[model samples]
Target: MLKEFREFISRGNVIDLAVGIIIGAAFTGIVNSLVNDVLMPPLGFIMGGIDFSSYFINLSGGDYASLKAAQDAGATTINYGLFVNAVIKFFIVSVSVFILVKQVNRLHRREQAKPSAPPAQEVLLREIRDLLRDGAPPRVIPAADSRTV
Candidate 1:
């Protein structure tokens, strides 16, 4: 059972999945940063300085100046700003993944679409086989003549 487990873990698919998971975790951090640090400030400014993280409903019926204050006061609140940030993060990550997949697919298609020349040996062998099957040597025709004489 231990050997089987080891073998399963050593498999290409398992290793690939592990790497993908690690990369995805790191990518999530980058997406979060992009949303929080880069995208949100300008967007918030454009929206009359409304911080999405501060947009919350106080369920405890307490007037709080900010989400941090509400949380510090132990008030139950629906934090919609955090949700908006999360949505933005998700969108950025999805777009990046989509672009990556699209480029990878395009490269795969290009590789598949390229026509490969047959090996010289194979071409030579085919010509010899055809000559033998037809019981004739290759006849060279003059460029001026259209008819096979």
Candidate 2:
């Protein structure tokens, strides 16, 4: 059982998957920051300076200035702005992953496009075959006159 576990941990695929998961977690943090801090601000400004982070409807009878205020006052609210932000984040991450995969595929295709070297033995055999095919025909001597006069 211990040996099996060790083998599983030692496998290249498992190690690669672990590394990928760690990198993906880090990438997610960056994408989330980009969405929340950088992208959303400009997007909100372009939409008539409306702050998307605060765009929500208070379910309770009383009105609140922001989602936090509504939540603090124990009011049920539909946080549509947060949902929109999440959707935008999803699109950003999806597009980035798509581009990365496309580039990797392009690189893979380029690697495959290179021609392989021919085998030395095969090359030599082909040369010999070509020589035989293009060689002059053999002349036949007469049966009675063996020597050339």
Candidate 3:
């Protein structure tokens, strides 16, 4: 059982998954920073200095100046503003992942579309085989024409 577990951990898929998970955790931090530090400030300014993080409904009867104030006062509040920020962050991460996946897929398609050339020895062997199969040697076309036999 221990050997099987070691084998599973050593597999390419498991290692790839571990790397992907670590990268994703790091990416989440970057996305959070982007949303909190970069995107939200300008967006808030555009919305007439409205801080989305402060937009919450007070469940507790106490009226507070801000979300932080309400929370500090032990008030039960619906933190919809924070939820909005979370949604925006989610979209940013989603679009980033989608674009990354799309580019990777495009590169894969390009690699698949390209025809790989056979080695010189293989090409020579194929030509010799053809020559032996027919009574005459294989006819060679000029370079201007397609070089394929």
Candidate 4:
């Protein structure tokens, strides 16, 4: 069982999967930061400084200045601002992955489009066959000349 486990762990596919998982985790962090820090700020600024992070629907019949304040006051609230941020993050990740897959597919198609050379033996045989077909004439060994050699 241990040997089988070792073999499974040593496989190239397993290593590639591990590396991909680590990279994906790091990429998620970057996309989250981009959505929350970079994109949202400018978007909020353009929309009359309306901070989306504080936009929430109070369900407890009391007005609160911010989401935190509402939560602190034990108010039931629908945190739509956080939901908006999540949606933006999902969109960015989706577009990025789509573009990446598209480029990878393009590269794969280019590789498939390239013509590969034939094997050396096949090429040599083709050349010899062509020579026999078009470049050579049949040698006529006259019956009378056969005895002279």
Question: Which numbered prediction scores highest in lDDT against the true structure?
Answer: 3
Per-residue CA lDDT of model 2 for 4-85, tens digit only, reads 9999999999999999999999999999999988998898899888778798988788978778989999998899998998
Clashes of 4: 0
Off by more than 4 A, model 1: 116-149
Query: Model 2: what TM-score?
Result: 0.78
The weakest ten consecutive residues by lDDT in model 3 span 140-149
Clashes counted in candidate 3 amount to: 0
Deviation from truth (RMSD, Å), model 1: 9.0
Q: CA lDDT, every prediction?
A: 0.92, 0.89, 0.94, 0.92
Tens-place lDDT digits, model 3, residues 1-149: 99999999999999999999999999999999999999999999999998899999998898899999999999999999999999999999999999999999999999999999999999999988888888775677767646666
Whichever of 2 and 4 has more lDDT, that candidate is 4
TM-score of every model versus the real structure: 0.77, 0.78, 0.76, 0.77
What is candidate 3's CA lDDT for residue 90? 94
Compared with the true structure, model 3 gives a TM-score of 0.76
Best by TM-score: 2
State residue 84's C-alpha deviation in candidate 3, in Å.
0.9
Residue 147 C-alpha lDDT in model 4: 61
Off by over 4 Å in 2: 118-125, 136-149
